[model samples]
Target: MVTVSLPTPVQPEFDTTIHRRKTRPVPVGTVTIGGGHPVVVQSMINEDTLDVDGSVAGIRRLHEIGCEIVRVTVPSMAHAKALADIKQKLESTYQRVPLVADVHHNGMKIALEVAKHVDKVRINPGLYVFEKPDAQREGYSDQEFADIGDKIRETLEPLVVSLRDQGKSMRIGVNHGSLSERMLFTYGDTPEGMVQSALEFIKICESLDFRNLVVSMKASRVPVMLAAYRLMVKRMDELGMDYPLHLGVTEAGDGEYGRIKSTAGIATLLADGIGDTIRVSLTEAPEKEIPVCYSILQALGLRKTMVEYVACPSCGRTLFNLEDVLHEVREATKHLTGLDIAVMGCIVNGPGEMADADYGYVGKQAGYIALYRGREEIKRVPEADGVQELINLIKADGRWVDP
Candidate 1:
């Protein structure tokens, strides 16, 4: 069997001072949501927002799993009422995790009612329309369109003013499939159209003198999402508005495909220092999105307090059940935050391969292993206790402290 040499690590371009975008900081409760604070990893709760117990339970679970901010969809008056109770419970229990109320249709009313309870409000631009296109094609025209815009403005005005007076923040979320018909008609259905829609909202907020805000220009299509945000950034720069940007690809499917698509859109913007916060919208449970968001941020070196696991794809040169062992160890240590562990099949170059790791295990003589920190061999252990022993070492090393 032919052996493949491990790939060499390319040295990163060195910079003494990391350049960060200069932005106006926006506070979401106790946590500063934007402006050079670490990129916030946010997730929406899947529980019915009207179910206070269920929503609170979901929020608590997400908090325990390291989700920083939790959003819940408030679809009606019942959900709006639950928001106050949920916020009170969360504040008493998980004091640090802020709750955002996701408002779409009737956002103005929901935003007004829930403003006092939730930390933030997410307004999706598409929900302002009262009639579907099919209904519109039969008869609706200028009057209906004008009424919709006027009603949207009227609905939004009080909440926007109240939030500003109370110093609360809001996120104006614009999705690709949900662009305002007015914007689509004026700019055409493209990135430029999306950017213009976002600008319209920004202008609205600015006119209301509401400076505490965040903006999102999301598209299910990655390229469109990227282009819209890029154009929005340029416009923000030209207009001198420094509102923090919330990044994501909306409706990014499920499983591996979702993760990849969200990562591609988020990473592209983050690498260039464009995004301020992110949410990876997936078809999966909201809880599942948290870890993926953290992973993306960790991989980008934006987040450091998570276990970094590296394992080899076993081959003919491997000894023992490498795949099974590694899989078990990975799953077992999914909650082992802030530790860097490596599991390798062979010692030939394994030690050299994982020099950046805090601790690692490599295969040796039958039922034996080499334990290491960097290139130094720390100990030899039986296969049965190898994973346990590594965990103990990491705990003792003070690399994985509880937050």
Candidate 2:
């Protein structure tokens, strides 16, 4: 029989990396969003803006713990003017942190003032040039719609020009609960309305040669938020607009479910490679949100800020207390960054499953554990000596550092 050497069987290559959507870079102080930079973490400080010292402390607290950008509410002219003091104190007492001011409800003048003090100014499209709804009116006529559009352009131009001339950025943050009556009537209470509202403001900004903009479409409900953002991406792509998107799930309540809800929306978009900056809007302290943000990014393999622990659940084959051992390994290595360590319960799957880890502690025989350095069994030691030996092995490899 002629040996048929069927063209050597080839395994298909699969890429496991997240390919983020391409977008233009927008600067917020020292940090840059999009243009292939690392995804940013941000949050809002609930301290009253007029309380200069408290606001400064709040901002410093968040920034010290990896909050890349911090936002404050500018609800009145006093709050708007107070930002100057806030910015000054932050620079003198701490470093100058990137600041964003949230302006709402006919905030043309307020936005222009806050634009001077903050690195970025965020405006709600529906409320920036607010108009009271007519209780008995029918749908807006074509001319009526155009007239309102003109009013929006007239109101939005000054702030856009100020930010453009100063080289500052703007975020067109549209909330589901705050949609304008015009948008609600024209496009209904839906994601399409949110996308359209953003597009209208974007066009005005574009007309003035101002493109340093970030956009957010946020809702309390996950499905509505997801749909708005996905639709926004589609519309932007079709229109050749490449502004970076800021992601969040607004008003997610406190505790376990809050984190889950925020993660469900934020991580889903991030995994799809859509978001540039993110804020987890939980009802807890702003400090509490930063950890959740980093966890999501780390879990996706986007950023490695802490040690990665890979452990197998204990079963009949397990020789030792897997949970306790894993906890010990983690406590010992938690301070070390950029390392992946594995704690396996049995030899049957330990070596094979942990082949990708930097180091592993595996259950071997009765009262013994095998230490591995990336698939190579370095040594076998008593179960009691396993943790320290793993540390010794890491030291030998020059990967250990004092905590």
Best candidate according to lDDT: 2
As for candidate 2, its clashing pairs are none
TM-score of 1: 0.83
What lDDT is reached at residue 176 by model 2?
95
Task: Residues 311-402, candidate 1: write the lDDT tens digits.
Answer: 88887767668988887777767666666788888877687778888778889667887888866788888988888787777667776544
- The C-alpha local distance difference test score for the whole of candidate 2 amounts to 0.95
For candidate 1, give the lDDT.
0.80
Q: Residue by residue across 1-403, what tens digits does model 2's lDDT show?
A: 8997778878888788998999999999999999989999999999999999999999999999899999999999999999999999999999989999999988889988999999999999989989898999778999999999999999999999999999999999999999999999999999999999999999999999999999999999999999999999999999999999999999999999999999999999999999999999988899999999999999998889899889998899999999999999988888888998999999999999998999999998989999999989989999999999989999998989999
Q: Model 2, which residues run further than 4 Å from truth?
A: 1-11
Candidate 1 regions with alpha-carbon error over 4 angstroms = 1-20, 92-97, 129-155, 331-334, 364-367, 381-385, 388-392, 395-403
Native-to-model Cα distance after best TM-score fit, residue 20 in candidate 1, in Å:
4.8
